[model samples]
Target: MTEIALRAEGLYKVFGRQPQEAVERLRAGASRDEVRPATAAVIDASFEVRSGEIFVVMGLSGSGKSTLIRMLNGLLDATAGEVELCGERLTGASAAQVRGLRRRRVSMVFQHFALLPHRTVLDNVAYALEVRGVAKDERLEAARRTVDLVGLSGWEDKLPGELSGGMRQRVGLARALTADTDVLLMDEAFSALDPLIRREMQEQLVELQSALGKTIVFITHDLNEAMFLGDRIAVMRDGRIVQIGTPEDILTDPANDYVAQFVQDVDRARVLTASSVMEPARATVSASSGPRAALKVMRDLQTSAVYVVGRDRVLTGVVRDQDAIRLLRAGTTGLASITHDDFASVSVDTPLSELFVPAVESPLPLAVTDDRNRLLGVVPRVTLLAALGNVSSHTGELPTVEPPPTVPITVMSEALDAADAESGRAVPSGAQEGAV
Candidate 1:
């Protein structure tokens, strides 16, 4: 079985005056009104984060995303239930236990960089190691390496004031990296940067994640950023998880009206790819072949279009069955006379989004090709639709409506008669004749 890096089961946290009493009252069946003045946080939430997975908890402000991250690292104790980190229970752990876990096993990067104004970037990163009792020289060396890893190689001696907002966040990331924890929790880590800088930071984080593979729980309110960074996003609404799935799953198949509205504006093609839509290519004929031979080939393949390749089997263009028909009617001598540049082509690496505008502008099927234009396969509209359907079905967003149950007239009458007998009701003579 895959090891879970973090697990929270029936976790509930409420902050207010007499919180314990409020919880007791609620457990005893008192309504929210009875606990209204005291309850300030989450309620009965559960999820697990697999080791090395980027599990994102995303929501608008006050939806409990921040509170959940804090509770994960034991910054705030759960009012009820348990939180386990790397197999260690945290719900009722002592302050020392929580502190030890924070120091050695988990680290967090917040929206604010939190770098000390007096410390240089190098010292800011080295602070975590210094507190852990490493020698000055060793801590400095480790910090330098971590700084380099986050693309801050030369900014080490500068104070936070000397760096841009993005650079300051890099310092914050370096600090966490220097701690060498198994899990990293990021709370709106790039939301403060300008759009351009935020994009750059997100890309940098993706690159870093690919290399590090640390179990990460990134909290963000931005849906686009969440889609880009998360392997699986847990969308929170009104203190509950509305849906959880991959970016492709969420965009193609939303779980409810809220989730559907959230993903409505997303460009589906940019998110879907060729590998998700391409079908195996069937055998085809060359454009230079005789028109009669090409017609026979099309008929044998049962295809409307045949991919035309050269002597080396490199794709030159496509020939349609209509072209063959026209050529045969006109008594054309060769396939070259019928071939035309009416087909659309795309590289295998091209994003599915790139094909949308062109596909709308033309009726031709999009051909998948290699860098050298060698035909790989074709993407038909039906294939794209089927792929979307598959994605939707897998994500539980699209309902699979079953056909209504069929009942014979005799069976219906028998059921009615049984109900009448149970009620001690008389059955009319006309009703018995109708049942027959």
Candidate 2:
């Protein structure tokens, strides 16, 4: 089981003269408007960040996401409730203990690059160690390695002013990493960068996480960023958590109308994966099977082609009815002579957005494979379009499709119409034979 790196139970952060009393009243079902003077920055927020997971807290401005993150790091005191970091209580811990925890266990990267103007990149990164009273040479050595890790190697000697906005942000990231903490609290860390730079940073962060395995609680208002970065997301509204789910869950089964509208604009193709819409490849024949057998299976399943799998369900190639019949008539008993390996294939984790080009190009349905290239399922063009069409009904608006490069919009529209017309009959009624 994964370890819980950070946990918040019954967290509430009220700002007013009588905060605790306000919490009691709010607990008794008092609405936010009723507690007028006392603003509830966070109300009954509870969630856990597991080890090596990116847990995103997402909400618009004034939704208490920032406040909730601040309280997690002990930067702000919660009016009521407790917080634990790595199994250590942080809510009532002394200032020194909290400082020690921050120094060794958790580090934060802010929206604005918080590098020192007068200090060089190396010095700014080493500052985290300096506060811990590490020898200057040792801290600089550690900072040098961290600077290289963040891709700002030669720029270590330059002042903050000498670097670009993205570079400065890298320096800030290096500083947080210099501490070598197990957890990172990134409050809108990439929000300040331009769109292109922000995407690059997000990708870099994912790469870094894969290598470093740091538990991250990323706070962001951008839904796209959250979907791209989060293992799971907690959506906030009016200082309360409205929904907590995976990107697909939030898109497909929103908890309320508010969440539905919030995610209406999200690109569904990017969020939905092949596994969500894939069906058992109804027609499949063994590679060792003869062309006559392949043709029989195809005819029985009412499919033009049948996927050919070797031992252990590893996909070898595909056999078309015409080719099989031709081979059979030409006295070819084995499928080895006629099997076509030119069909398109994608991993089960592939997003629906990537299926269009392959779906358009492949004569057969796109094959879904595992790491071992074993055929797990198949995604038909009709199934892919039907899934995208379903996206419109859920969002209450036409899906915003940016047709892939080479696939025309008119072609997608026609396919979508056919899919809608064939609704429940997406997958043909055939027995799943030899499917793993």
Candidate 3:
């Protein structure tokens, strides 16, 4: 059975006296705008997060992203409704219970890094453990390991003032890691860093998430960041959740015009994964097959290349039609010796945008592999262009998750221009040692 990390049901938070009247009115078919001047910080916002998933909560300023995250950790009390943390009700828990849960179960990463200015990086990170009454020696050891984990191995002795904004943020993250909490609540954790550093932090966070598998509730205003990191995103507006879906789902099928406009300028390549552009491979050849037989198979399929697989369909290498024919005529026996690893491979989860350069650079199609390195599909260069081309222009149709067969040749030029423009802005994958 799937373990749910957290769940919020009919959650509502309102500030000011006589809150129940406003809550009742809002619940009885009243709009948030109508209940204005009442300070409805959150209204009937409910969602569930699966264990080990990065759940992102995003909205415009005043959309209640921060409020929602605060409520999740019990840092802010909900006026009404229940919050279940790891199947236990956190809503009605006493202040002491909430404090205990926070100290042991939840760790938060704030936007403006709250590193202790007086302490060194190592000491700042260890402070969280120290608060829990952990021994000084043990906390420092744990803090040192976390500092290394966050790529801050050499600067453990430096104070917060001695480090740049990015380095300080890493220290903050290292502090959270030291706690070893099951749930992480991050509120605009990287919003302050410069573009390059922010991107690096984003990548590192994804790396750590992959390694640690901590259930995370990340709050952000950046849609691109949310799309890149979120396993599922909940978009809020007017103190209410408007939509909840995977990035793919939100991108391809926005809930309304508000969302559609929000993502209009987004660079899709970065957000769309390899699975989005990947198509069925043309053909496959057994490692035992002779070069002549492989050439014949390519001819039958009317293709230029085929992926070669060893026993159990484990991918070996790619065999081009020309290579197959040349090897056969040169007296080569089978595919084992003739196949080449010229093509780069990515996992099904790799974003389509990262492949833009590799697609243009490599002659062979990109192979998509599974956990065991079994061939799942191939993302041909043309398929990638087709996917990008279909969205580059405001072509009449709504964008669908499915990739198109072929796009106009102009796709290459337009895609490049868009890619460049998207890089400077904060518009916001995968595996098998894939080359980008």
Candidate 4:
């Protein structure tokens, strides 16, 4: 079971004296207008961050996402509700207690690089350890190691102004890594960089997460950024969370129109995984099934190819219709002669965008498999294209692939549905073709 590193329940952050009264009135069904102008920065907010997972809290201006984050780290007192870190409750903790927790257990990265202009990069990074009164020699050693970790190896002596925007961000990241804190709080840390620089930072964060396994609470307004970095995202609206799900969940099954509109312009192809788009094979044959049985199953299913599975449902290979017939005439007893591994196979979490080139080139449908290489579903080229096209439509753009004569969008959904029993199908615009 995954362990939770941080938790917040029923949290509210109204910036006024009547917080309790406001909460009571709202709970009693009073219209928000009746609450007057209390600036309810956050209301009834709750979320959990799992150990080693990047959890994102995201929304546009005035959504209270930033306020919620402040509450989590105890930078701001919660108007109501509770927050626990690791396991220690913070709702009523003293100022010193919150400061100690922040200093020793969690680190925050600001949108601005926050590098000290007067201090060298090395001194700036070691400042955290210095604040704790570590010996200068010990602190500098630790700071050097962290600086190298963030890719600022030789710039230890340089001032913040000497570095590029991305480099300065790296310094901030290095500073956060000094004490090996288990949790990181990043509030729009990449929002201030250029687009290309921002992408680089995102990639670096992924690599660092893999290496460090820090529980990160990332804040952003960009859906694309949230989708790219977060293992799970909580979408906020009007100081309240409207949705909490993986990127694919938010895209395919939005919580409501508000969420749908917020992400309507997102690039679904980039965020969607193979597991989201793949459907089960409409027809499959066990390795023990003879040529005749395989042929009959193919004929019944109306597909030209049949997947061959072994014990435990491991996907051994695929058998085409021509091979099945040829083996039948030759009186082949088992599926040995016709089976081939020429088809493409992808893991469930493979991004749909990664499949674009392979999908177009492969003659056979793409197989979606689990960790044990067990067959789950397939992604045919047409089905893949159609899914991409549908996302395009959501962005108010034309789909790139004109539907071919043999395939229609409605038929695609039906085909996927027929195959989607164990591994649900992913269609362009929710089409249901049986498993690919």
Candidate number with greatest lDDT: 2
Q: What is the lDDT of residue 269 in candidate 1?
A: 65
**Backbone Cα, N, C clashes tallied per candidate:** 1, 0, 4, 16
**Candidate 3 residue spans exceeding 4 A from truth:** 153-158, 282-302, 305-312, 316-344, 354-366, 390-436
Q: Residue 361 error for model 3, in Å?
A: 7.0
TM-score for candidate 4, please give it. Answer: 0.87
How does each model score on TM-score? 0.71, 0.87, 0.78, 0.87
lDDT of 2 at 90: 91
Q: What lDDT does the true structure give each of the candidates?
A: 0.76, 0.85, 0.81, 0.81
Ranking by TM-score: 4, 2, 3, 1
Candidate number with the higher lDDT (2 or 4):
2
Q: Ten consecutive residues with minimal summed lDDT in candidate 3?
A: 427-436
lDDT of 2 at 165: 87
- For model 2, how does the per-residue alpha-carbon lDDT over 1-436 read when each residue is reduced to its tens digit? 8899999999999997789888998899998778879899999999988999999999999999999999998999989899999999999999999998998889999999878899999999999999999999999999999899989989988999999889999999999988888889999999999999999899999999989998999999999999999889999999999999988888888999999999988888998898878888877899889865775575555556789999999999988766765665555579988888888999988999999999877766789999999999998776777777763333445534342222232332333334435453342333223211
- What digit string (tens of lDDT, one per residue) describes model 3 on residues 1-436? 7789999999888887678888999999888777767788899998999999999999999998888889998988898988988877889899999988888888999999998899999999999899999999999999999999999999999999999999999999999989998889999999999999999999999999999998999999999999988999999998989899998778877899998888777778877788866777657888888765565555455455678888777898877755655564455577777688777788888888688777665545778889999888887666676666544323334434322232222332233234335445221111111111
lDDT of 4 by residue, 1-436 (tens): 8898999999888776688898887667765567877767887888888999999999998899999988888888998899998888878999899888888778889999888999999999998898888999999999999998888999999999999999999999999989667789999999999999999999999999989898999999998999999899999987788889988888888999999898888887899888887776766888998865675565456566778999888999988766665565454578887789887789988988899777665545788889999998888766676666654323444445432122233443333344343244342342333422
Put down candidate 1 lDDT per residue, 337-369, tens digits, no spaces.
666666777777567767765544434346787
